[model samples]
Target: MLLLGLAACGGPPAAIIGVDGVSTRAVDVPGTHLLPIYVATSRAASDNPHLLFSGERSDDVSYARLVVSVPPDRPVGEVTRASTLPPDPRRHFVVVAAQVFGSEADFVSSLNRDLMERPAPRRHVLLFVHGFNTDFPSAVTRTAQFAYDSGYPGIPLLFSWPSRGRTIDYVYDMNSALQSRDSLLATADALKESKAVAVDILAHSMGNLLVVESMRQMALLGRFATADRIGSIMLAAPDIDIDLFRKQLAPLPVGDPPIFVMTSANDRALALSRSIAGGVSRAGNTDPEKLAELGVNAVDVTRVTQGDRLQHSTFAQAPEVVQLIGRYLGNDGNLAEDNDDNPIEGVRNVLFEVTLLPARIVGGGRVVVVNE
Candidate 1:
């Protein structure tokens, strides 16, 4: 596939920006006018600014370090959908910047300067694993978009695999992601083994499967102790076979925090996915007996409304789902508020809240709790 990227630029350049009480380095990238704010961080300005958590920016060939520090006085949600961010005195929910480091050598050379120069005790590091039919540039832009939208105050990293941005490439893209799972592990392991900052995962669609499989792989092997770095995992409309997932992922190895799986029966996209694959995808369909057995806390999304498709991508489409993701990531985990008026199966509920009844979770009521 022809990749849309930036032409080769020289050595990395550095600039200074102040948000809150700290000063952070502004690393340059391909398109400057696209995103208003580049990065915000907790690393002290006195520290080295070259070293930073890096990523390939939007298939553009340029790489960057994403940091956000929300201003203490401002509400982050405002800057989310706005065209121009980094407004004066708005309390930096995020400060961001990137640099063009052509090779792994250049990326490493600028690492220390980037990390040490920002405010210490950084907020969060969100690694977004985008689903099918997306390009690297699309992934990076969306990562910034969600970070801005969700008002997340942390460095947003995009773990992009080569995807052909077309539905026909589904099989190829799926294989590509699976094949690159080890590379993802290696990258994440580097972070897990580093002193950079806190880490979390927000994976959508097929990306969710890859994220889970990667973590599960790392956890099972006792490899990177950093797998525990995952504060929370947001699986949005994951397209995986329920039966296969159970057979493969049940009894996952113990890690630091619990993993959250969000699904919806109203996801029309998943319906298409079902038609294409001819099996029950894990998003809305799973064995009721296996919730706890798989060590996952599932949430039914049919009651929620998200995007244009009213589709499988509910995690990003709906405001409530986004809020729930924030709550989950923020450690504001409250089971009671997990529903309010909505009764579920297990906190462990099996009901998938589908618009139609499929005799499973679709026939809503309380999901039958199993071995729990």
Candidate 2:
């Protein structure tokens, strides 16, 4: 299958890294550094060098290392794969370097090498699961953007399943995601079992369904690591059915690490998903009270975004939202105990109330209004 640009113009950058499965070039971005991404995917391999994988499931995982160049001024935006070093200024990314691993053991060894190369206290690994309608390249580039923007001090890894990368192929994508449960679980297990300091998960849209189900299955089989290695499970704009989410949450062991649900009532994509599911309220769009009853942290971003499709990615696109996530992740699963005088503090059930400021006062500072 020919994978179109995973995201349109204003979306994440599209790029390729290797030729015939081998990385050939490295680019230099002045005034900024390259961000490396370690990726694991279940998509079937493809011969196309520009597009590494096809929209078909694979029994074994494919591993690759991607280096993305961050622009000096803006580190995140729509970027395209450049054939030469020092990409055009308009591009948000330049392919610095990449290498594909031949085996799972080789991949793990490379991961260990990358981990050791990071600075002190960089043991944290953020695992990102992309939503529906994404291709391999798009998934890689998007994860790089999130990792760079969040100021995360650890390795950023992606668990990409075979998404057809077309809105019309939602059903096909859903089946593909569901069929990759074992693959997702295997990736998570490898992370937790590795030498990484901590493992944190961030899932978007239907990816949450895969994450929730995988964790549920892992918990049922008594395969969780002790000592808090697996940290927060942040669900952004989850497209999970509320009833089904509750069912999935039920089997999880008590005292499972904090799970944060980041959602906005105005998510258009989820709205369509809700209608597709016969108007059932999605877990990501549900009220805080209901989420609190399920023993989860509800981070409502309704007011954080003013009126735009950017609301869907407010978790990553919004600077204030990125700070919130970076701070939360940096805190190592410690929910702010000092709620007093905190702009994010809210009522009992509400963990965070994110909002935005008028465009006048702080040109870029969008205020997060707490619902105290």
Candidate 3:
């Protein structure tokens, strides 16, 4: 594919504006903006940030310290979607800078140096795992967009696996996701070792499968503390089979962090995923009753969307959804303690408020009202 990236730019300049405590690095429309990234990939690295991979997976994990420059033409607090990198002449927010590291220790060292420069509490990191068909540049931009929009006060990290980045390679991506499991676990360990106060893991689409399976592997291996160090596990538009999801949840140690599953019946992507798995319903599209029975917090986002076709990624685009994370789930795990009658802002309807249901229900109610 012909990538739509800006001409490569040199090092970052000094001036930056603070937008609501978010250090906004602005640029002229035709200019580039630099953002640092701690990349953990099972894919081979490229010399060019625009072409992030050679499109093949390796059995062993690879690490890199990258500084990606994306065009800030769309302004802060907004994301411009492109079917491909370097969207178009009018939509060119592409990577303009990249730096590679030779070893995991080197990458971790640089990441810690960057983290120490940030303000307090910002030492925490928000780790995002991208779903099927996402290339490295797209993953970086999405991570930046989420951080910018949420006003997240922490370092942002991305776990990019070798997805073929094409809609036709579903089976290939699934295998690639499985192949990337150990690398993801290594990333969790690296963050915890780096002195991050808390690490929040958010996975979207097929990436959720990788996240759950990797955490399960940790539990089965008796790495309970490592899994527990992950403060929150938020799955958005997960594409895992319902039965498999049950199996994955079965091994998690007791008192592990709460899992938040954001679902929407309007999620056409998950609907297609449901059909692809021989007509079995996917966990992301399952009924609230079943999710409650499983003992996880379920947020129904059918009423929220960014007017996008799939509606699968509304959690990152919808303002209310962003508010739910930034205002409620940030820093502390307070959202887990919220009740239906006293639900957090931007989280209306509590959709399914089972304490753990089938696992344990807080108040013994079949249905609860968080919002009228």
Candidate 4:
């Protein structure tokens, strides 16, 4: 119903790289920002040159390096794309450069080379896993937008699974995510073994399921020995069942790369998912206190009103929320405590105030109360 309608709004245009006699080298625009996004995908190659990748699954993981140009003068949280072909770099989010690696060794070598060029503190890596109904171009653009908005100096990487990018293909997308778990783990391992100082993770919606499941596997395999190299693990609007999420976290040791979950009770997409899952509660709509009891930091954004019509993307679409995340990352996986120099200090103050109050159920949704 509502979820289906929201999904029908469509995604970004097909990525035009090395097509229409366009150069596959970096395109420089005076006011625009260029972001390099390293990619590890489990999707098969597409015949269409504009797409480069398709929704079909591949037996082995593929690697690529893409440079995206972010339009200047746009809103903080928006990633605008050109509606027509031969994208305008000055005004639209377009791929300015692309390189497909023929071997895993080549990709690692290139990534490490880039890491060495950055200052020691900026040698970290940020890996983003997109949720259901996402395509290759959309994921690439989203990663660039997040890196640019957050002012993150670290390398940005994308682990894209074979999502059909259709709202009606929920079951297929879920299976695809599960199918790509091994590939995600391999990608993470590559990052951990690279010359980078640390690897931070950000996952949205159903992507949380993939992340958690892969982490559980990592724990079982005793891969947390080098967990010191892992930074924040932020889950935004997870669509997993509450009980399943608990089981997944049970195996992990305490404080292994400190986990943060962003929840919003008003998320209509999760509400619909809950109904589809036989009324099982989705983790994204759970109370913060309940999540805290599970040894994870939970930030509730139900009070924030900025996002798309469905309210599922508030973590990225809300200016205040995105700024808060950017500040958290900039602070090296920890949010500053009462810093006046922080631009989003007012939002942080409000969040702290609400967190102290007890939450109560209101008309089947959770809401915080004030001591009157």
The candidate 2 region of ten consecutive residues with least summed lDDT is 358-367
Better of 1 and 3 by lDDT: 3
Better of 3 and 4 by TM-score: 4
Residue 67 displacement in candidate 4 (angstroms) = 0.5
Listed in order, each prediction's TM-score against the native is 0.62, 0.82, 0.78, 0.88
Query: What CA RMSD would you report for each candidate?
Result: 11.3, 7.8, 8.2, 5.0
Q: What RMSD value applies to candidate 4?
A: 5.0
Candidate 2 residue runs with Cα over 4 Å from true position: 1-15, 18-26, 75-90, 306-310, 335-372
Query: Model 4 segments beyond 4 Å from truth?
Result: 10-12, 18-28, 226-228, 337-372
User: How many residue pairs clash in model 3?
Assistant: 4
Global Cα lDDT for candidate 4: 0.77
Off by more than 4 A, model 1: 1-98, 102-121, 224-228, 254-256, 284-293, 332-372
Error of 3 at 20 (Å): 26
Between 1 and 3, whose TM-score is larger?
A: 3
Q: Residue 368 deviation, candidate 4, in Å? A: 11
